[model samples]
Target: MVRVVVVDDEPMVCGFLRTILGSAADVEVVGEAYDGAAGVEAVRRSGPDVVLMDLRMPGMDGLTAIEHINRLPDPPHIVVLTTFDADQYVLRALRAGATGFLVKSTPPEELIGLVRTAARGHTVLSPSAARRLVAASTDSLSARDRAREVVASLTEREIQVLAGLGEGLSNARIAARLHLSEATVKGYVSRTLDKLGCVNRTQAGLIAHDAGIVEP
Candidate 1:
């Protein structure tokens, strides 16, 4: 089962997430919290496989919570809950160790799929979100040049795999698209992340966008 925690300031939002996630046979809402501090506690208490974290909250915000959770041993995958317009916060959250972000208005089935994707240690990025991130990034042309230079060092297959990640394709989907085994795709993903010195797949995906490997 994929255990999950929902952290939102509003009780109704938390309850709604609980209901939607609970309806899935393979998913369980293990805990809920109203703020960043409590959210961190909930994660520690439940040891869930995934966390749906709201970026804005009273007292402590989602970004701080994500950082705190990341410091925990064997941290769970954190997918920020946002309006999708908050590009800065979303990008900061990803940099602080969130696996990805989900627009609050995402379809129920798609939300479940994204949660499962994050649980499997894959990035849960949307093309639209990535585009916004790329546009909002303060990185100048020099940064883009650096990103491209770093990408050039990768093998052609690894670059393809990274582009798959830029498109938010999971390992299974990337494998099918490339006509390679899922295990091979997984290895390439690992090597690519290591080569880029990225903390997570989300960072690498963002780099792929900056590098123009997959247009944002």
Candidate 2:
């Protein structure tokens, strides 16, 4: 089952999601919080599969929470919640490593489905959010195109390892999933990182995300 935590300053919003999420047979609402700090604490303690994060909370807003989640060993997927017109916060949240963005007014019926999709490592961006990302980060194409060109020089095995890492799989997990030895996966990961000119998995992930090649 997909476990979720909902973080919103408004108590009603939290209750509403709890009700709707309760109706999803494969999903469970594991926790709720009124601010980003409390939300971060809840995530550390509850270990939910996903977090529905509101970007406008009073203290240490959702973007801050995302940074903390990124530091975690096995972070929960985060989907920043915002009003559609709040383009600035949406982009900030995405750059902070949120897997998706959802409008606060999204129908309760669709919320659970989107949450499920995000928990499985898929990203969500509304049409307006997509447009905003394209506009705000048009420069990404130039950098992304250059990065892809460099990455294309990787050997097939290195490419596979890089793709697995882009999907957030640990080296051991990648080895088991790909039917390879752990040491081999680690070696491939090192070579892939060097070939792509990326120092860490996050940078490589950003490239993969910008290039739209790694889904789930």
Candidate 3:
């Protein structure tokens, strides 16, 4: 089973997530927290495989909680849940080690799929969130330059994989596009992450988009 924790200040939102996630036989809602501080405690106590975190909270906030959670010995993958697609902190949260972003209005089935994706150590970004991230990449010139340098180090095939990631395509789709096996595409993705020194595929995708390996 994929263990998950939902962290949102609103009790209704937490309960909503609990109900939706409960419908999936392979997913288990292990814990829930009403604030970032309590979210940290819940993570420590539950040791969930994934955390669905809200960006705005009463105390400590989601960004602060994400940083703290990432510092844990064995951190769970965190997917930020936000009300807006272009939330100002989305880029910063990704830099702070969030695995991905999901708009709060995402369909329940898609949310469940994303949670499973996070559990499997892959990044999950809603379509609108991906566009927002790519559009915001131009805001940091120095970061883009560094991303370009890192991307330049990738092999030709690896570059193709990174482009697929930037476009938010899954491993199977990437394989089909590049005419490679899924296992081979997965290997390339792993190597690309290592080369870019990224914590997750979402970060790598940001770099690829910023570096012009893929059109925004």
Candidate 4:
């Protein structure tokens, strides 16, 4: 079963989500919280597979809470399921490590499927929302030029690794494709991240895509 913890400041929203997802045979409402702090506590206690988080909650807020939760030894997948998807908050939430973004207006069945996808470590984004995010990013010529310079620092083999990462391939898959050891692929990925001035693989992929190094 995919255990879930629903968090929102409003009781009605929390109850509504619980009711909607609770009906699924593959889903279980392990706990609920009215604010971010309580949501953190509930997540710890319930050991849920996914967290349905409201981005604008009081007392720590969803973005802050997600950062904390991500620091846990075994953090649950986080889905930013909020009424608001403004540029500022949505971008911040994604940067803080939300597994996906789902507006509260999403259909219940679709929401349930997204929750399941997140539980399995998938990166989910509504198609329109994703386009919006990409368009929202400035990606100025300077930034793209800088990104190209950064990418150019990598060896040809490492460039291949970045392309694989942009396609969401794991270390093992990259290794197989390149006829190299998994450890070698991991090293290439790490070096690419360092060269790209990125904090993680996800950021590197984003930069590569935006710079047209990896193309969409």
Candidate 5:
């Protein structure tokens, strides 16, 4: 089973998420928290595989909670499921080690899928959230230039793999698109992440976007 913890300031939101996630036989909502401090505590207590977190709260806030949770030994994967998809929020969450950024407006089925994806150690982002990040990239010339420099250090094959990541394609999908073995694609992804100084696929994907490989 994929154990999960839901963290939102609204009790209704937490209950709603529990209901939605409960429908899946493979998923279990193990804990819920109404604020960031409690969210971190819940994570420590439950040791869940994934955490669905909200941004605005009475104290600590989602970004701070994410950083705190990330510092835990063998921390769970966190996905920010907030109503806000602002550029700064997205960047902050990801930079703090969130495995995904998703707005509450995401479809129920898609949200469930994203939770599962995070449990598997892959990056997730709502389509609209991704577009916002891409837009933010265009507004910052320095970020774009730095991204290009990073890309320049990569091989052509690694660049192709990164483009696939920016497009939100899984390893199997990227392999088929590039006509390479999935194992080969996985190696390329690891190398790309290393070259870009990224901790996860989401960061590499953002770099790909900033570099104009996936385009806005």
Candidate 6:
């Protein structure tokens, strides 16, 4: 089972998440916290496989908590809860080692699926969040230039893999798309992350989007 913790400032939101996640046979809502500080504490104590975190909270916002949790010996995968208006926070959280972000209005089924995906060590981004990332990239010329320079180091096949990642495709899917084995795709992804100076697939995806190597 995928163990999970729900962290949000609002009690209603926390309860709601717990209910939906609990409904899944393969998912267990292990804990719940009403603020970021408590969220961090809960994560450490419960050792959940995934955390559903709200971006804004009364004390120690989600971004700060994400940084702290990521430094732990065995950190849980964090999935930030956000709204479209909080796109900036979403990006910051991702940079701080969050596995992904989900809009607050996300359908219950998709939200549960994303938690499962994160537990599997895959990055998740809502479609709207992905669009915001593309928009953010469009406005930063320096970032674009740097991304392009980094991407230039990749081979043709690696470039294809990176593009697939930008589109939120998994290694298995990328392999099918490029007619390569899953192992080859995984290697290409790791190499691409190293070349782009990215800590995870999410960052590499952002770079690929910024470099215009993949359609937004």
lDDT digits (tens) for residues 1-216 of candidate 5: 999999999999999889988999999999999999999999999999999999888988999999899889999989987666775776768866788877788888877888898999988774456757667643568878988998999998999999998888999999999999999999999999899887778778877877889867
Of the pair 2 and 3, which is ahead by TM-score? 3
Which tens-of-lDDT digit does each residue in 1-216 have in candidate 4?
999999899999888988999889999999999889999999989899999898787778988898889888878888887666555577567656776678889888787888888888766664345435645766446656766777877888978888776666678988999999999888888788777665445556555555665654
> Could you tell me which residue pairs clash in candidate 1?
none
Comparing 4 with 6 on TM-score, the higher-scoring candidate is 6
Candidate 6's residue-wise lDDT over 93-194, tens digit each? Answer: 776678788888999978888889999988887445665766774356876887898888999988989888888898989999988899988999988888
Instruction: Estimate the TM-score of every prediction.
Output: 0.85, 0.67, 0.88, 0.74, 0.87, 0.87
**Model 5: lDDT to the true structure:** 0.86
Worst 10 contiguous positions by lDDT, candidate 6: 125-134
Q: Write the per-residue lDDT of candidate 2 for residues 1-216, one digit (tens) a residue.
A: 999999999999999989999998999999999999999999998999999999888978888988887788888888888876447667667666787788888988888889887876655654344444545664666856865787778887777776676666678888998899999887887777677765455445555555555552
Once fitted onto the true fold, the runs of candidate 1 whose alpha carbons sit more than 4 angstroms away are 140-146, 149-153, 172-180
Which portions of model 6 miss their true places by more than 4 Å? Answer: 126-128, 137-139
Candidate 3's TM-score: 0.88
Clashing pairs in 6: none
Which of 4 and 6 is ahead in lDDT? 6
CA shift of 105, model 6, Å: 1.6
Q: Judging by TM-score against the true structure, name the best candidate.
A: 3
TM-score leaderboard ranking: 3, 5, 6, 1, 4, 2
Go through the candidates in order and give the clash count of each: 0, 0, 0, 0, 0, 0
lDDT of 6 at 13: 92
Better of 5 and 6 by lDDT: 5
Comparison by TM-score, 3 against 6, better one: 3
lDDT accuracy of residue 60 in candidate 5: 88
What shift in Å separates residue 88 of candidate 6 from its native position after superposition? 2.0
Which residue pairs in candidate 2 collide? Answer: none
Candidate 5 regions with alpha-carbon error over 4 angstroms: 126-128, 137-139
